[model samples]
Target: MDQDGRDQNFSAASQVNGDHVEVVVTGEVDMSTADALFRAATPDGVHCATLDLSAVTFFDSAAIHAVIRLADRYPGALEVRPSPQVLRVLEISGLAGQPWLKPPS
Candidate 1:
């Protein structure tokens, strides 16, 4: 699919609450959509305090890289709840137990 077409399969939204922002993401998370995920998770140069990816259906290494970069940018300041799909990729990458990652709620 074209970039626009691929983009349509993914979405990320950020909600600010007090001192932190919660970023919610859904749909396929591949190379084509990882950038958008990063942008939504980090707004105004601040990494989001929480990442909600429970609705993500297709997760890839690119998405893992994006998430890792986000965590690296803020260390313990970030927490992520991942979908099973995202979790699988994290497990394969040996990043599933990282402190910043949490099981889905």
Candidate 2:
């Protein structure tokens, strides 16, 4: 959680389900916090990664770029759960149709 009473800041916590890892992220993801986001998503021994950003309140281009880079680095191993805000950014950036960024149901 952040001092400003926002949803937890850009941090990742994980749980293992059989062979997969689900990384739930909450809070804002921006230029200043992209490294943390990247590191959290690319932990060791993770064969499958899901980034859940439903609680995220904000996202910037840096976050989007980081997501793209991470996906490119890991290819089929990465899944992104972007919040509506994050999804909007991807849609505006022309990245919504990317294979790694599936629309929320």
Candidate 3:
């Protein structure tokens, strides 16, 4: 799909509470959608960012890198609520249970 088509299928929204921001993401998170997810999860000046990926259906290395970059930008400030698929990716990438990652319950 084209960029517009991919964007229409994948969406991210953030809700800020005090110094924390919860970013809710829905749809596939591949190379085409990773940037938008990263942007939504890593907003400027937010002390903490919580990425809610409960609705995410697919993800790849691009999505993993996006999360890694976000963690690099703000260490110990990112909480990730991963879907089962995303959780598998994180586990395989050796990012699960890291200080920067909050695995799904």
Candidate 4:
């Protein structure tokens, strides 16, 4: 929590599956917390990765930039599954249609 009494909950955890890695992210994501997101999104020696933002409640452009950086690290191997909140932002930013995003089922 910050001085504003808002729930500043933020967390990112990674799981390794063979050469692939899956990063699950949750909570509010803003500029102040984007760096940590980038760090958690990048796992060494993992060519393929999945960023599951389906639990995120809030996010901003900083999160978009973080995803971009992660794309740089993993290239074509990064997949992002965005929550409704995140999906709205990504759609607004024109990133929702990017190849890094997991196609809707």
Q: Against the hidden reference, what TM-scores do the models get?
A: 0.88, 0.81, 0.86, 0.86
Separate clash counts for every candidate: 0, 0, 0, 0
Q: Flag the better candidate by TM-score, 1 or 3.
A: 1
Over 1-105, each residue of candidate 1 has an lDDT whose tens digit, in order, gives 455556776888988776678989988889988998887777664544898999999998899889989888778899989998888888989997899989865
Task: Specify the highest-lDDT model's number.
Answer: 1
Order of quality (lDDT): 1, 3, 4, 2
Q: For model 3, how does the per-residue alpha-carbon lDDT over 1-105 read when each residue is reduced to its tens digit?
A: 564566666889998888788989998999988998888876667888888888888989999989888888778888788889888888888778778656655
Q: Measured by C-alpha RMSD in angstroms, how accurate is candidate 2?
A: 3.2
- Candidate 1 lDDT at 64 equals 88
Which lDDT value does model 3 have at 86? 87
Query: Candidate 3 — which pairs collide?
Result: none
Give the Cα-based TM-score of candidate 3 against the true structure.
0.86
> Candidates' lDDT values, in order?
0.84, 0.78, 0.83, 0.83
List the candidates ranked by TM-score, beginning with the highest. 1, 3, 4, 2
Give candidate 2 misplaced runs (Cα > 4 Å): 1-8, 16-19
Q: Tens digits of per-residue lDDT for model 2 on 1-105? A: 467643345676777776567778787888777767787777676677788888888999888888888888678977887889989988999988877776778
Which whole-number lDDT from 0 to 100 does residue 26 have in model 1? 88
The digit string of per-residue lDDT tens for model 4 on 1-105 reads: 688744469888888887888888899888877887887766677778898888989899888889888888888888899888888898889887789887457
Model 3: lDDT of residue 12: 94
